[model samples]
Target: MAGNMFGRLFGKPKEEVSPLSTLEKLNETLEMLEKKENLMQKKIAQEMEKAKEFTRAKNKRAAIQCLKRKKLYEQQVEQLANNQLRIQDQMIMLESAKVTTETVDALRSGAQAMRAQLKTTKIDDVDKTMDEINESTEDMKAIQEALANPVGGMAEFDDDDLLTELEELEGQELDEQLLAPSTAAPATHLPSVPTARVPAQAGKAQPVRTEEDDELAALQAEMAL
Candidate 1:
């Protein structure tokens, strides 16, 4: 029997009920309860009026009976009010739950989108791409530098060979300097003293042999040699 009951319970597919529809139902229930409570209040008032009439007619039992009926109506009205409060509370909870559900769903969607985006690119792939870019940049720079260089492969010169050639030139210069004439001043030509000099007075003292006269004599003697 239990198996049959469970089968029956699970046989029908559950209907999808939206929070809005549920809230509307709760609101309707609340309205009905409010109306019923208002009617009960009216009945209580009528009972009170009837009780008053019985008291005026001196019918104690009828008056007591009316009061009892009034008490029972009051209890039902209180119960209806409680039911309204419970329905309002349920509506508030449903509203809060609806907002929470939507927020959670939005967060879940965002997470899924982020996951999909991440799937498109991996860290290893990114690193490899960056390495390729860097390598390409370096290669491009090398090409540019090669293009900017002078066309002839001979643009580059060996420092050691250049220094050796400089040394050879310096040796040549030294040889030239050594083969040049000495750095002495040439003798100055002066007007030969008048060859037709008047004879000196026989008695005049001979001219003194000054150092300059000696130098002149030595120079003339050498030239004559």
Candidate 2:
């Protein structure tokens, strides 16, 4: 029966059934609710107008009853509006979730590609590193051997020997100074001595000449002639 063609196919209007696109479906639902609300509001307004006429005719009870019904109708419309807003909020959340999923997938794919690239890239410095290590090892060995067998120990020992020789030379110099003449000033204080001057004789001193002086005078008188 589901596959069979209906008997009255000509008179029946073809109900256009549109496949709802995502946002279009939500909008269409919201629009349908709005239309229903508007229709309900018009009905409420008509009731209110009828109640106003009853109030003008002094029917207070009927007016109050109409106002209460209007309030209930408004409350229902408000509830429907809230539901529409909630649906919109859900739609927004769903779209955000979809975007987040796509972003995460892209990031994951990129990460995997990076990992693959890292695996493929070759680091060719192993031999170079080993060569450097060997060279450094050889240098260290040479240094260690040089330290173990130091050249010319005598040259290093000469500093101590030279110091000993200097000490000996200094001791010899001190001995020579002690044995040498002492030309320095005396250590004790002494009193000064006065020297005497001899006085000369006057001319009355008869025969005040020595034999040598008489001899010298005679020789001078002979030479004068």
Candidate 3:
């Protein structure tokens, strides 16, 4: 097929050609036609100037021939313009088609890559990996919290037993207070002295009373003589 296209482009009749090759040929032809049109425009201008000079010199036959040549150049320029327009239109359409083809090929390649990735990796594997990551993160957080905590700070004790012990101590303190005054020893009573006395002569020695009374009595603060 490529051989046929090449043959078609180079006039070999048996070769095929690519689309890019066809567009390149059209561009070359358009450029050549544009150059021809420019040359024909120059020729038309020259012929018109020549016709004006001949008319001024009163040469009727030469002026008519120059006018005829100018008309022929004008017709050729019109034909080249039309051909260039057609080739430009063809190039625009071909370029648009090439861009679209490339875009579709890119999308096809991306889809194939996605299919290959899906074949290698599964949804179950993704879910398992995410679950493992979450578990590992939670474990790390627990380790960090343990490191930041004070040692033996959360040790538990029996609150009811502690309250019972405190109540026993309070009861012992109350019993000690209630028995305080009764623990003292009792006071002993003794016999009282008699108020009667015998007066003697000034020269005589006083008698000593060493004997106690037969009965004991409570003494008053003030005693009568």
Candidate 4:
């Protein structure tokens, strides 16, 4: 199979030509062409002076012939200038292409190196990563389980059982309240005792009383009192 002609067209220049180098070459070429054009203009002027001298010497035809030759030389110089411009354009394009090719090759090599490194790495490394992931999962599971089922001393009394007991105590208290007396009952009264009434005797103009009578009456009165 034959390679592409464009790819094989030219060998690399002595310098690894970059865009800047291409631009520098273009500028140098332009300056060189400009200098040549200037020199050609000076030569044209000298030829015109010579042609004027020939005319002053009454040789008009020869002077005209010299001017025509000078015009041809100027045309050739203009053609050279156009060729220099074309070469500069080609160099600029080539430099851009070279930069693009180098960038692509660097990227390709980097990708190839990464793939080679990946191939060289141990397959067991993935297993180790999986094991670490499983360990973390197990730790999380353990933490979740601990949160779901609390351990040790206070585990005996859950909130539901405590709430049920509290409700039962409240029910008992309500029953006790329901059984209490509505209004307080009055205390029982004791039976009353009957007393005899003494009758008063009629007076027979009551006898005059002696001291002994008075004393006997006093003693009876004292006994009755």
Q: Which is the leading candidate under lDDT?
A: 1
- Highest TM-score: which candidate? 3
Q: Candidates 2 and 4: which is better by lDDT?
A: 4
CA lDDT for candidate 4? 0.79
TM-score of each: 0.50, 0.39, 0.59, 0.50
Residue 203's C-alpha lDDT in candidate 4? 67
Question: 1-225, model 1: which lDDT tens digit per residue?
Answer: 997898798885679999999999999998899889999999999999999999999999999999999999999998998898899999999999999999999999999999999999899999999999999999999999999876566668776998999999999999999999887959766434322345778989767666577567667866776
lDDT of 3 by residue, 1-225 (tens): 998888778875456877799899998999999999999999999999999999999999999999999999999999999999999999999999989989999999999999999999999999999999999999999999989865574446566987999999999999999888864678564546455567788999986644333222224412332
Clashing pairs in 2: none
RMSD in Å for candidate 3, one decimal? Answer: 17.5
Taking the tens digit of each residue's C-alpha lDDT, what string does model 4 give over 88-167?
Answer: 77877877887898999999999999999999777799889899999999999999998988568778778998899999
Q: How displaced is residue 139 in candidate 3, in Å?
A: 1.2
lDDT value, candidate 2, whole model: 0.77
Worst 10 residues of 3 by lDDT: 213-222
110 Cα displacement, candidate 1 (Å): 1.0
Instruction: Tell me how far the alpha carbon of residue 16 in candidate 3 is from the true structure, in angstroms, after superposition.
Output: 5.7
